[model samples]
Target: MLTIKSVSKSFDNLSVLDTIDLHVKKEEFVSIIGPSGCGKSTLLEIVTGLIAPSNGEIYFNEENVTGTTNKLGYMPQKDVLFPWRTVLENVIIPQEIMGIRKKDAEKKARQLVEKFGLSGFEEYYPSALSGGMKQRANFLRTVLTDKRLLALDEPFGKLDALTKREMLKWLTTVRMETKQSFLLITHDIDEAIFLSDRIYVMSSRPGRIVKEVHVKEKHPRSNGFLLSKSFSELKNELLSSLGV
Candidate 1:
């Protein structure tokens, strides 16, 4: 579980996040969505400890984690996979960084690669994989590292609509298998609705939580879930919340 309490971030005179409060329970998948430049990514960076928050606290399982543990796996807007490294090699980078023995790391990486549908492509480089395949590799890398929490900052933002849908469905499968706490930032309302256990809507500029809605849809949702009336209503509400 992760908790952000009264967290705010400012760059000089510009205030971005304003005392934002949110939480993700164990095994929960949560998302934050707002108009562009709403400090969603900034909030994520603060939680990841890439940047210190201007104010307040971040806790993991009830302990203050500010400037602390490396229990977080952050996937940015881009996969940023090493073009030179093969898929197996890319995923093992985390294990390498953690100083785990090569044999142990490869054993875990092999299982994860196969689980993510990249078993045969393990020897292939980034160039050999499609966008969706690359994202899977990216997610697999994150999963390989931080087995606790996944902080994904718009990982699907760069994909085409059809590819994005496919990624979302695949992502749901991935999350179910991993059971990691995921805090995702997405601009796509449909994507948020399709993937989240709960969705938090943020106000623009000096971002603050405007609304939080629990997604009642079941996990591993069917394709028809996206076409349901409940999905449309929630999407409309999110759009209206964003003032789009």
Candidate 2:
């Protein structure tokens, strides 16, 4: 549903991305992994129109969208929740900003919280929720905007290992129900493999696509899939491609 062609970006003569070309099909979950400073997030920002690329084109569903538009939902590294707002309020913030009617927006938000496993905590403040719950609320808020594509930047980066794994499982279940396409930037290799349809391995800085590995696994993937031989093979291949 998305296409990026010959895209490049630079800041004050320092190039961050170099002629990157990528295509993401509808309902496809793609994860991008690379070493630090490799412009993984920069490339995502370019796609989301948060940053303008120095060259090339970005298209969504056949329309060229080189700059920011409301068709995409983004969850950045930080949760950026309003401290004073309750979980339900935070989840409805996007709808409020988009001029959606309060009652309708809130109803939709309630559905999201319930569907995503945040049912009873809706009235609680962000400070009262754990890191994983906060991230779940942040995700709900992003998707509530009714965007076609979700661009996630390390949504589970800050959680403890156990919580991160639990969130990944929850995310997989949510994806099965929602069928939303996502472009995720993650540092966790196993997490990427577990959740993504395809993994894009990027070069170190001045980033370019080094390799793309297809996971070849079906959805509703189990924890057993991670321990299977195919999973280890693909994971090792990605590591080798990255020279890790």
- Compare the candidates by lDDT and give the number of the best one: 2
- Superpose all Cα atoms of candidate 1 onto the true structure and report the RMSD in Å to 1 decimal: 1.1
State the C-alpha lDDT per candidate. 0.90, 0.91
Summarize candidate 1's per-residue lDDT along 1-244 as a digit string, tens digits. Answer: 8999999999999999999999999999999999889899999989988889999999998999986647689898877899989988898998999999988998988877777879799899999899989998998888888668999998988889999888888889988987888999988888999999999999999999999999999899878998999999998888888887
Best by TM-score: 2
Which portions of model 2 miss their true places by more than 4 Å? Answer: none
Each prediction's TM-score versus the true structure: 0.97, 0.98
- Pairs that collide in candidate 1 are none
Residue 93 alpha-carbon offset, candidate 2, angstroms: 1.1
Off by over 4 Å in 1: none
**Candidate 2: clashing pairs of residues:** none
* Residue range 116-212, candidate 2, lDDT tens digits: 8898998899889999999999999888878878999999999999999888898999988888999999999999999999999999879999899
